[model samples]
Target chain A: MDTKAYIASGILELYVAGQLSEKENLEVAEYAETYPEIKKEISEIEAAVLALSEAAAPNKPLSFEAVKNRVELSEDTKLIPLNRGRNRWLPYVGWAASAALLAGLGYFYNQNNQLRSDIKLAETEIQALEEQIAGASDSLEKTTALLQTLRDKNVTVIPLGGQVAAPEAYAKAYWNETEKQLFIDAQGLPEPPDGMDYQVWSLTLNPLTPTSVGLLENFQTDENGVFALSNPNQSQAFGITLEPAGGSESPNLEQLYVLGTVSS
Target chain B: MQLEELVERFKQKDLRAFEQLYAMYARNICGAINTIVRDEVLAEEICQDVFVKVWEKSDAYNSSKGRFFTWVLNIARNAAIDELRSKSHKNQKLNLSADYFVGILERADDEPNGNVNTDRIIGFIKNLKQKCIELIDLIYFKGYSQKEVSESLDIPLGTVKTRNRNCISQLREHMKQN
Candidate 1:
């Protein structure tokens, strides 16, 4: 290719002025790259245009930083933060935080309820144990009193044999004549039927007269069937009979379960 | 060392390369804008805007397309022309015909600061034909292509290229002499 003829064509000048189309510009660019003379010619043309324009320029030139700052400011203004505005990523992060917080609160609430129930169960257990201790103490006091009565010098011990109503039922009574109190052990008796109770009576055997002393209401449920009854009458014997609900006005003779006598 | 290397670095978004490139052409760009806009302040402002645009659009530029200075010059010309066409400048003296590089020389000569030796410019211009002046003005300063110059100057289409070559050769000789 005649590089000089191409240079003389004034295309390089138009190329520098950006008047050439893309293909022509690329051709010129290739030519300029390949040939140093072509390159120098293009540069000289650019320099002439530059000098012309510079002479036409105002006396003072602008600072490059000022222009760069404007560029930077424009970029800063245009850049939206990832979290700002209606970003696609923002909703996902927000939902994730909300879900995590909800789960945490739910877990804490469940734990709180479980702890509360545990405390309630513990309180109930403590109440039940307290009741058991009180009952045991009361039973111990009753047994000690009964032992003192049996060891008393003026007390007479009598054995009661089972009668026709329950032939296997037996009982024992300790009479403290000075104190007018009788302590009966009816542990050998069977449980009375529902709505029925066992009543003990002080009796005079010669006249066959009976006086009601006390009724054992909770016969089956009582762990120890030791009962303390007042026997103020001059009793020669004691009788136990099964009576109807709320205890009978007089003992049903047919229901007599045991009988015992105390000698003077 | 070469202008190609600087332009290549500029394309790669090298700030230092861009600064060097700006220093090389900023005065020319301001001169070109001042020629058209005729207001130094407005020309400087537009010149800065043009350079910034060149930096931003550097990627769009390819040596295959044109010279980097040509690209920057095109930007300055378009910006100045756009400013002239804007609504605000509509009422201001509409001397669209006088919007040329020669107009700058004329305006400068009229100014107090234009004491700088314009004899070189005047002597160079004195030898050129009036048609050459209009052709150079349209094709170079106003960024008109050959066909537009032909149509605007009512000349033969083939004459625009040859005539422009001669005119530029004369200008280059004058520049060398100065």
Candidate 2:
């Protein structure tokens, strides 16, 4: 394109004047972009026009803020969100902080209520244990009275000695002939290990046979160290052995902790 | 850095950009309205109105259409013309002679701070033929197209562009001198 001819064509002057049609205006805009000379010429023309128009302005200067207010009013009518940072207000700041604090308080209150319920649950568990201790002490007194009855003059006391399996273990049996009850004191034996408990048996010496009695269910936890057994058989001797928890039908001879004969 | 970039920011509702653009063209816009209205108070009012209108209708401006100043110029001229044609102005004593910009230049001679000297402008304006003034007044100030200017000035169809070029060149020389 002949840049000089385009410049001399005077379209740039009208371009500055804004008198050109849309198509012509776009063409001029393209030329202005492609050629610096065209752009310079357009600027010069615009500068000249600007000076002329400005000289024609009234002597009095108008307020820029008054015009800005009108702009703001129109913006409000259009519901455009204004930049609040440029114009600050105290109420907006206060309201924002209040909302944040409200949300934080609501979260803290919920956590507080949960902690209160947990504390209540722990208090209830402590009260229930106190009742169980009181019941255990009451049962110990009744057991002591039964022990006193067996130690009478008609009772037979058998001294059981520890056998080869456990020489340190010993036991004693108090037999009551009339009542047909036997109380075994196995305090000389150690507590059975986990998954196993001590079983007692009554023996008849003539047949050399042993009969199952009962297992000491609370051998480890029982404080008194005495076990009550029913002796209905005509037994001349009694033996105590460590059997399985449910008790065996016959005494475990290898596991026999003690043996004694009842003197008639 | 570019004027279009500045105007685009203004369209996006950038206040700093708007203020810069206002500072750049506010005087020219006010001057243009004052030339037609001839009332300083009314000119200030219309100038502010024109700026408000510019901001409100910022989306309507496209660089391909014209310069930013030209777009603002069109707004100021239209607003001034509308005020002139309104019922309030129509009933008043229309002081037609004092309304032209040349009258302001003539009256400024008596004031101490009148930077625009009438003799200098008239001398520079003399370089432009009588036809140049009529074409400039119609096309630039009145927002008339070549066809309209040609019909108004009784000029031939082909001469409007060349004549306007000559008139603008004279004004450009006058601006360079001051």
Candidate 3:
């Protein structure tokens, strides 16, 4: 029999663990008896376990006298000192250890709490990241829709030039005639005052009439200086004007920031 | 004397042989018992009783049952489990980490629980892996079968034997070093 193969099988360790069946135990024992190398390996494994188990033995004076006194069968009565073993605990010392056990228990309890808090912190971080991802996806969807609208064949691009009120201001209007929708990119325009907003007007040059489109609501805080407004009338020009917060019923000619006419 | 020879003598009811066997195995047997009972005094008491029973049932112990120490370990574990069940109403909650015998050695540096030489034992097995600690605890101390350990730990059944062998090899290496 290959003793190395037998030792590597871990049967001897299981034998020492006493988890092997009786038949298996008999086979292992027979192998050990036959193979000196297998026998040595088995004993070494047993010794390591013996050392570990001995480490858990309580600290007490070992005297065979204590056990000898208890056993009276006496094939021959001879007292010998227990030379090596560390023996078991004394009663009082074992009892006193209850307090020490409590202290150990408290330490483990605190460790458990710390681990729980760590998990909670990790879960909170995951939730915050999830919220950020959701916000990003929402913005991505809105931008995609705006891109599709701007690229539509029915849409007309109208460039707006800076007016006398604010020569530096420039804006562009994207008009999708089929859908009666207008998108204004006012990236070059300055932010409106706290109590005021910029409104777009659909103007017909023949009558010199201006129809209120919609206010550029929340323009100061809007990172994307883009707005969508409805324009149903046949308009020759588009103008943006700064008005009081809600938006004015008509364009404030003095505050006209930009003026643009349809290229068509 | 060789362990086999001592066992042969012990079977013949030789008082010297019995004393030698008890002295050889008593500490390890008691320590193994304490891991279960978690009570040193009770474990010591059980250890004494187990030795007496081992003497009484000496003829029944055979090579087929395993090594002499394994037989004693079986008796000690059964007695400890019996007592634990009777006293289960007293709130003896055991956590996975702290209840293990290895836990004692690992925690022995600062907290003096279990045996006096535990810190020394920690020195011997300081570099031991967590998997090794768990395998040793379940197989040797808890008396779990390889299949039971595999299921409980959710490891492949074949891994149990090989892992335990490696762990024992590591332990032997540590012992040889220290």
Candidate of highest TM-score: 1
Residue-level error in angstroms, candidate 3, position B57: 1.2
Sliding window of 10 residues with minimal summed lDDT for model 1 chain B: B112-121
* TM-score: the better of candidates 1 and 3: 1
Off by over 4 Å in 2: A80-264, B91-100, B112-123
* Residue A68 of model 1, lDDT score: 76
Q: What is the DockQ of candidate 2?
A: 0.38
Question: Candidate 1 on A10-69: residue-level lDDT in tens?
Answer: 788788778888999888888877999998998787766665666677865468898778
**Cα deviation of B29 in candidate 2 (Å)?**
0.8
- Who wins the lDDT comparison? 3
lDDT of 3 by residue, A122-230 (tens): 9999999999999898888888888988999999999999989999989999998889999999998988878989999999888799999898888877757789888
Worst 10 residues of 2 chain A by lDDT: A80-89
Q: Which stretches of candidate 3 lie over 4 Å from their true place?
A: A73-264, B89-98, B106-108, B111-118
> TM-scores, in order shown?
0.62, 0.54, 0.53
Deviation (Å) of B82 in candidate 1: 5.2
Q: Which lDDT tens digits does candidate 3 get at residues B10-81? A: 998787999999899998998888777766788788887777777778889889999999998998888777
The CA lDDT of each predicted structure is 0.81, 0.79, 0.83
lDDT of 2 at B128: 62
